[model samples]
Target: MKKKIIVAPLNWGLGHASRCVPIINALIKDNFTPIIASDGSSLEFLKQEFPYLETLHLPSYNIKYGKNLKKNLFLQLPTILRAIKEERKIIELFITKNSTVSGIISDNRFGVRSSIIPSIYITHQINILSGLTTFFTSRIHQNIIKKFDECWIPDNSNSEFSGKLSTSSRKLNQKFIGALSRFKREELEQSIAVLIILSGPEPNRTFLEEKLISAFKNDKRNVVFVLGKIEAVQKSWVINNCTFYNFLLSEELEHKINSSKVILCRSGYSSILDLAVLGKKVFFIPTKNQPEQEYLANYLEDTKLAPFSEVANFTSEKLKEVKFYKGLQVAKVEFDVALFSLFHSKRKL
Candidate 1:
């Protein structure tokens, strides 16, 4: 009988769901039955993309951001625990229904994946994001990884092009998947210029879009704005040389990213992975109070893989830097080891 795998993705943001696209495709190619367990919004998206896959509703450990880190941490703890409990129950029930479930791969949903089957947890941050120094973050993260069958990081381990942001490692049973990006190069590259990918949970995404539109009103560069599907209600507006697309599918967005000279986007992992694989320069503006994005943006800036500007200070000068760093290129797909080997033995039912 064919192996059955279930992907339990966290619905905190679309990044979790988006990053799994390639993994799901790989599973489909390998002929593994891949079931998706996610919340309403993520399930809805997966339903559109893979209607054939079985899906179950799962709870999300949503974050509550405050102006300061301490306040945000305190506010979110309870919600996270509640979500973990809810997710545990859901996964237990799911495994009960699908006794053929061979393995579970979790994209940041710890509780659900831990509850059933041989579970693999995928997370770049192994330790808690806060209260940990750089010296011990990797060590702590590795300790956490011990709980799962395996852990996967979506980044290149090579130093030449990786920058500090994606080079972190956890030795045992941990794999680097070489930055899973939805964008793939197809046509010849063009230079119509700067493409800005606007995404993330709402209010912040809208806020950033408005800020960019305001700042670049008089700029003479070709700009493509992807407002995301959630923002479909937004009316299209042309400002100087910019063309705004309300929403873009993976293929269309890939074309825009390739055609553009530079990309301006939020510093989410999935977005960073896409830019990294394409070797495109990016001006990342991470969401406010979002520590993960902030860390990646800072790391990118420090390592010189990409440049970033705070939403408060995003300007034409920052936009100009994208052109200078266009020379840097990283080899894509350098590390794509098979995932099946991570387990002691493939459990076929």
Candidate 2:
């Protein structure tokens, strides 16, 4: 029997779920059965991505974000802690019920681990980007990360792709995975002038969609917009020169990315990894008031990797500057070796 590995990702957004696709595929290739666990849109996302796999529902952290995360996070801390504790119990029970399970991989889900099996924690943010509380938050997160047998930092060794986000100060059993992206780069024609991929938690997701639509609805360029609404019925319609989609699975979204000349998206780490894999130049508009996005946007710009703007400052005129910035053109798209190493020491519980 193939050793079963539980792959659990956070329910915050599709980024965590999406990045896990390549890892899940690698698991299957390495002859391991991957059981997915997640909640909310992320769960819906993986089900669509891998309909054949058995899935377990993990409770959502539901730490209300965006309406001021830095301010609201204080109010949600207790609930967040309780959620992590519950997640740990649920995973332990699952492992106990199925002694055949050999391992676990958690993508930022703090509690999805087991002492019985080899567990891996995957994250790019060694330096959690909370304003004022960054030092305290990073220390807390680092402690949780140390619980796993090994931690996987999904970036190059020097943390070139993620800047300071993945650079850990204290030593731990960490491996630098080249990069995690589901899409493969292909030699294709760039037919679309602009492709907008919007993601992250709600209110903000809807907010960006509305703002961009109002700004560019009249433009005659060949623009395509993906709403990132995984729950909504999949739909597409053309308005003026732009085509809008409710959501697109991996294959379809890859085609969209390869067909576009300039891509615009939130500077989420997963999105950055995907764009790097494709070796595409992009313009980013970080989600308003979100600290991580803001930090990534600035870091990418400061490093001359990509150009970004605040949501309010992003305009048709500002987009013209994207041509001047050099995206991660030098970053090699090599993911196999590091991914294969993920299974080097799998032990039966």
Candidate 3:
């Protein structure tokens, strides 16, 4: 019988879950039964992607963000810690009931691992980039990561796309898995003049959507806007000069991306990798006051790979600037050999 593997990703935004698509697909091709575990939108997303696979909820972090960073973390930090504990319990219970499950792969979900089985933590941010708390936060994350048997970085060894974020100051069992993206470059016609993909947590998600829609609603150019909302069923509607989707699965999204002349979205790491893999030029507008997103946005621009703006300051005219930036950089799927080796190897812990 094939070994069963638990594939869990954090439900922060679609980034974690979306990147896991390639890994999950790899698991299937390697003859492992991948049981998708996540909560909220991430779960719904994977379910849509692999309806044939079994899925379970791992408890929602239900993380929300406001314009203020200090207040947001102070209030949500406790809740996040509690949720991590809760998810650990869920993972343990699930593994207990399914002894056949041989491994767990968690993408930015700290507590989704088991002591007995081979557990791997997937993240690009080994050094958290919050301005003042960068050290504290990075250390805290490293501790959580150390609990896992190995760390899988979704970047190349040079860390071109991820940069220092993917680099660890101190080494743990680590592998540079190259870029994990569920997309590839294609020569499709540009049916979408602009693709506005809005994601990240809570009111900010809605805020960006509203802001972009308000900006483009009266424009002559028709744009495709994808709102990464967590819902059981996918929905679509046309408003003004834009077509809006509640969410889109890989196949549909891939087409939309390939067909777009210009793309705009949160500078979320996963989206960055996705664009990088497709070699698509894009404009980034970080979610308000999210330091990580802001940092990533600036990092890409500083690297001359991409341009970003504050959502409040972004306008229709700004899309033109994307033509000047270099877009994202990518490496081949460098982790596949390493991933397959570990998947079949004896337990790391």
Candidate 4:
């Protein structure tokens, strides 16, 4: 019998859940039974995709940042540490109870996998955003990663794929897994439909949606907005040739993204991967006060693959001025040997 695998993703944002779609699809294609663990709207979205897979309600933590950077960090420090402890306990309990799980794959849930079992940590941000860290900080992050059997980063090896961000690291074991995208690449079609995905938590996501709606006030493109499978106030409105949807399913959503001319969305790692794999033209808008989004937005724009707009510069003029990549396909895609090598250890629990 094939070994069972559990795919656990951080619940703070839908990006973790969305990016895992490709991995889950690949696992299913390879005949591996994958049990998905998450909470909130992500759990509902997963259930919609794979209704038969086992599901677990895991706790999630989101670091809150206020307007004043210093005040936000001070307020969030205690809660952040407490959340880590809580997450660790939950992971330990799950492992103790589920003996059939042969492999554990995590998307940013720190220290959750079993010590004796084969586990892989998947993340794009190996470097913290504080930017004022000592060399010891990177070492500490590397040490935490060492606890896992493997580490996988979703990035292209080519210079055009990754821009400005330092891919350099002392850890030789890290692997570059070409972007795992949710959208499948398909033949080009002449269409005017546009799919806008709304993700992340709270005020920012909603705020971005409103900005997008306003930007399309006099535009000629069709638009549909997905509110990340959450239960929110719903309204149907049409502007010019655009239609907005609060949510959509796997096949329905994929169809829309495939047929669209341009994609306007967040610069989250998962979304970027999906766009890259599809070879679609994209416009990225990073959230305010979030350094990771800012980094991705800046990098994509600098690399010339996608244009980015910061929250402060979100306007119809900017969106209209953005250019999209039409004929670019990253041919050099490879999986991180460090990440999948854990399978060879024969470390069955």
lDDT of each structure?
0.70, 0.85, 0.85, 0.68
* Model 3 steric clash pairs: none
Residue-level lDDT of model 4, residues 185-280, one tens digit each, is 666573645567888776677777787777776776566666664554444566666676667766666777778777778888777776677667
Q: How should the candidates be ordered by lDDT, best one leading?
A: 2, 3, 1, 4
TM-score per model over all chains = 0.85, 0.95, 0.95, 0.86
lDDT of 1 by residue, 1-349 (tens): 6667888777755777877878888877776788888875566666666878888777766654546655765678798789888888877777777666778888878686643457888866644455445456556456656778777767655633334433444455766666676666555567757787787765677788899888877887777787765332435677679888776656766777778777888888777777767767688898877777887777777766777888998885677776555433555662353775443354434
In TM-score terms, candidate 1 sits at 0.85
| Model 2 TM-score (2 dp) | 0.95
- Cα error, candidate 2, residue 265 (Å): 0.8
lDDT of 3 by residue, 193-307 (tens): 9998888887788888889888897888879889988687789999888898998889999989989888899999899889988888899998877877888898899988888
Clashes by residue pair, model 4: 222-242
- Mind giving the per-residue lDDT tens digits that candidate 2 earns over 1-349? 7778899989876899999998899888878889999999999999999999989998888866766887788888888889889989999999889866888899999889988788899999888888778899989889988898888888888888777778876876888877788998887999999999999887788888888998888888999999899964689999999999999999999999988899999998899989988889899998778888888889889988889987877786677888788875545454563544544555554
Off by over 4 Å in 4: 66-74, 134-139, 158-166, 232-241, 324-328, 331-349
Q: In lDDT terms, how accurate is model 2?
A: 0.85
